[model samples]
Target: MVRIVPFAVEQWMDEYETWAKYNIAETCSASISIDDLRSLSDDPSRDPLSTSTKLTYGAIRGSQTLRSHIARLYAPPTGDDSSTTVSAENVLITPGAIQANFLLLYTLIQPGDHVVCHYPTYQQLYSVPESLGADVSLWKTSGEDGWKLDLEELKAMVRPSTKMIIVNNPQNPTGAFISQEVLAGIIDIARQSSIYVLCDEVYRPLFHSLDKTEWPPSLLSLGYDRSIVTGSMSKVFSLAGIRLGWIASLHRSIIEDCAAARDYTTISVSQVDDRIATFALDPLHAGKLLDRNLQLAKRNLGILKGFIDAHRDTCDWVVPRAGTTAFIRFSRDGRPVDDVALCQMLQDSKGVMLVPGRRCFGEEFKGYVRIGYVAETEVLETGLRELGEFLKAEYASVPLI
Candidate 1:
């Protein structure tokens, strides 16, 4: 009897992704096979899967090797080591980042608690908290100004009953990144209020478009013990098939509470998944895998940029600073086009599937569409080529909202 709103983005994908010829709607960094993972390793002879290892319920929390790797992600860059290092005990592995997000929300939120969440993000960030009977306030950001969140506005939204503040970095649909200064500001506010800050950082470290100096560290690394970050091998590592992710926090109590709540939902993730995730995150392979993906993201993003530039008259966007998605708006004669109709017609006619912004994200996003642009180079090129043809031939007919 939990009357939760349907997860529109997920439902849309489930409905139309099956027969998509050019799956440009996918958000992962072009999924890779186990063999492909091995190829990236300096020692290609080592197999990712342990052939003789018997499958059991594995570690209740997670394998030590996997947890260690996940912990290492929060450590400061090589030359900039910090006193606040995360240990294996500080991490709890889950089936995916989705489960990690859900488990944390379920453990923390209660009826009548006020929650502030970043808007225009993956719906689960706000929707899950709302379903838990919490009063959720959306901290809105706009595409016109590059999806920037104003810190002063966030301060105004906080209430005495506020228990948590949630955010998504390298946000979904828009792909705008939060800067270091803004992140510090958010932490300062949360710390003063004694509120928990949960950051869904599933798309992190894939900052293909940012310069080295512009790269921001993980939220957990900001020296805030109340901070919780969830990440996975799905996005940056391109290993969605493994379905491995983790919840990390410097606060032992937070990790302990999540682990307790996790007992009913998941005793342990698949043993095979644990092994694969460990191998994928191994230092020998992780760097190479990231390098391959970073190159692909940079290349495909250029192709997407070309398409945007060529069709500037009809389409406009806040070019993504990181992550795989881009939010673009389409208009005809100075009026917003019907995004649902445009998406359906494009997918049905040309097989270039896309998520309609108005239907999936919110009604206010009238003519917007979310494009996962970090697909393989050839797929993006072909899809955009076909999309260009669709725009030229079919755009005029797309009714304005």
Candidate 2:
């Protein structure tokens, strides 16, 4: 077995305490509460006094109620069956979306398989597959192009041995989304190549502009039997503490394969966590939480954009249409700056920590940094001000290369 080193995402967690003053620790959503989790539990009449004390390995394949709720989140409305119609048998609730992605990679990819993923996405998408001994190739998202995927390049990258295509819509850091047309095109390519599409859709439904008539259709809703979706309450619903996520696939074989693989890995999600997740998924509670998050994201994004406008000469962004984060590029006289050095300088001097883009990509994206604007609006605004001050001081002292 190839030994995988620690994840870069985990490495950044250490800097959080040092930079707490700037409040850029906006990577994950705010923690959830009992109020957010009560909907998933059993009826008071059925289980009376809640026996969470009896925690001897709960359901191995998640509770039917929780799994059923997760399934409804993924299934689209059909002729005879509404979007809500999904079987609990088709769901395998895992520890989190991270584990869900890991299980999918373990189940579908072999050591020598080839997998394609978008660059500067949630690092786990590529890292997990690489750790599994698959040859990983990146489909780079251009900053100039609003970080959209180029299907033409994607077509050129696909090979006969390609086993899976990983995607993160409402993408991390960049917040770029795959349009329905682009998704359709990618699906066609995957179908021709006989590859499965794995979508990390944790950030779904966080659209900045709710007035848009059409939302990007989920890959699963496109009717691709080979497509699998992994989602969680971590981001969209701001229930990261629940640690509840699941995988949904139209193909029974894939679902069974993941279930078998899961047995060796997580075995099952915690019963308490699963119950809380189910409660959060309740339409009333889930909708309210998502609405609140969207409002926060939009307000924070505006604050970030205002800062960018103030520092147009030092930094700029593609400006995400949706999602919680944005990728910002810094340069002097059109020459790229050292993002890692800049990130470290900001951390040490101003106590602002931003994720260096190089950490998001294997080798590319050296001059960019991924910053989240999902915190309180005032917090994001303050961080941006500190970032601006740091950049101004840094560039003022050094000559453009």
Candidate 3:
């Protein structure tokens, strides 16, 4: 008999494409075009005259140049470096960050292995491991405390069977960052237990401002040979269409295992895609793109914050310090609203879509919603106005519990 998957796949199937106003995808707002990418790949001196000819399966472990560029992101400064330096040998490119995550889970987790993860965070981090028959436990983060992970609670949940701890910094829905202190505490716990740490660093360097706050140092940078850092071009470079991502690890053994597992799934990424990704990694180009995105996110976040403040009685948010989305709690007279019903009503009435928090966390976060504000300025402003009007009308009609 075939064993069925243990995770909730049905919940995401229909909802994935339903929310975009332009089929609004709050998951990733970055846009990339074929023409734009081709411009980056032009090399007059090279013998290849056409882009289509370069479409063959490129490198099994990704192009050396591409891997070198990715490594630079985590490399230590040239002289008297305090941080660890990463090499191309330590990196393995994958289809996207999501695929890299799956590869890690498949490689590290076995049927009886136990994994600890922070909740009200990315669903895939826990779900994938659970599906593989790993015993998964949640360490909850409180919204009232700015969604900060409770180190004490984490300490309490550790078991001898625990094999790994998963973290998403500048967290998805809440946008709560894991501070250096919290990261150090976690590292200490992991080191004591010898548990591997899998950190999803896809949102690194997307901070609101370089001066606003110091982001957590990479677990790899901490010199923990067991730690794995996964990242992608989707969020930072605004090139999700290229579908380029990678996993970096100081541990040679884990890197080998992930590569072996990857052989069966993808073998290698597309050649043209890899070439364009390399071009996009040019320091000057990347710096300009990141700066533009940061400015846009800052402006849009302000618009969202002002809107939320105006409707404080109906909604409240902790205000994300980073990332593309924010989570908001909805309630009336201290009684929480049904998020599924609210989401459906808002979508049907105002053509605005918000991901229900039930999908992000478990049942406890039902009254919350994740909203994306990284769209064009006019779109962000208009979407919020529509949402506010819809909430007002709904509140006026429904009886307060």
Candidate 4:
């Protein structure tokens, strides 16, 4: 039996994703039409992919070609760090990053083991460990610190029993990333304690265009033998429909173990889906998609910043440096706003949808909401207006608590 609680964010998305007219809640990559995908088929290089057989379960450890592509994505372009080119043997394909986490936690954690995880992250990073009976310590991120995870606090929390540390970079909801220096420090901490780091780096490639000159750090490179990075085509590729993802590690044992655990559920990703994902990762196509997402995040973020500026007193946000979403607080007289009520009222009155912070960040930050402002430009404009109207009409700043 699955002991984990039902995912509240998914529940909200289920009911409203289709129903909402102005959905600013989605953090999708550049939307594509079916024809747009079909257009990729026109490429002479991808012609052979169409005939890929589907009768077989596909390669057990992911197709060598697909894994090779994934491996290359993490390798440094040149110079001193070039040695980190992950091999196919180190990659394990999963249905999605969510499932990748499941396989890793199920493989590594035992009852009574300690796990330290960054909070306000994708819930499975912490909750799944708890459900597995690991004593979970949350390294909570605060708005006052720009939602950055504090290393000193994490240093205080680790114990001899700690087995794993789950981290999400360009993190969910808050959208803050750890610097290379910070990542190196974490790697040091993990090495000293003999802890494995499971980094959910789904948003790594989605760094905002504002910071294009610099690159996001990779835990696989930073943590040496003890790190595992998992990601899906979902976030940065806008390929949620494909149900494709992978886990990359330097240790072949972790990949082997996750593959063994994968036997219980999702033995292999779709043969056809794997082929398409492989096609999507082709150097040119992949580069094109990267450029598209960078443009979208840069444009939409500016729009979001303007909206935040307009309501500066009523709301505030630490502008995101990467990823499609940011954590925003709606306040009433300088206190946390009732985000649940606000989201409900907006849905009812304006048909708007925003994730309540409690759903992603946990109970301590209920006044905040996760807004994925990377919607179609017109849709986002109206969503912001709707949210503004509702904020003004009801909670116009008379402190309650």
lDDT at residue 371 of model 2 (Cα atoms): 81
**Which pairs of residues have clashing backbones in candidate 2?**
39-279, 40-279
Candidate 4, residues 1-401, lDDT tens digits: the string is 65888777878788777888788888676566535655655465544246646469888777888888888788775675645667878889888788888889988999999999988788778878888899999888888888877889989999999999888887887878877778888888899988999899888778775454566568887637989999888888778787888888998888888888888887778887788778777676777777778887888888888989998888888888877788998777667777777777778888998888865567887678888866677888888888878778866542333
* Candidate 3 lDDT, 17-118, residue by residue in tens: 455463233545446565554454345343212445646677899989889888888865456377778889899999999899989998999889999998
Query: Which prediction has the highest lDDT against the true structure?
Result: 1
Model 3 TM-score (2 dp): 0.91
In the range 219-329, model 1's lDDT, one tens digit per residue, is: 988889899999998999998888888999999999999999999999899999998889988888888888888899999998899999999999999989899899999
Give the candidate number with the greatest TM-score.
1
Arranged by lDDT with the best first, the candidates are 1, 4, 3, 2
Clashing pairs in model 4, backbone N/Cα/C closer than 3 A: none
Which lDDT tens digits does candidate 2 get at residues 1-401?
66676677667766554546775756665545674345334454433125655876778888887787777676664563533334777777888888889888888988899999987787788888898899999888788777878899989999999999998887887878888899889999999978899988888868775455567867777877898888887888777776888888878789899888787778678877876676677654566677778888777777777888988888888888777777887787787677777777777888887877776454567678788778766667778788777776765543322
Model 1 accuracy (lDDT, Cα) = 0.92
Ranking by TM-score: 1, 4, 3, 2
Where does candidate 3 stray beyond 4 Å? Answer: 1-19, 22-25, 34-52, 77-80, 209-213, 397-401
Model 4, C-alpha of 26: deviation from truth (Å): 1.6
Lowest lDDT block of 10, candidate 1:
75-84
Candidate RMSDs in order: 1.0, 3.2, 3.0, 2.2
Minimal lDDT window, size 10, model 2: 40-49
Question: What is the Cα-based TM-score of model 1?
Answer: 0.98
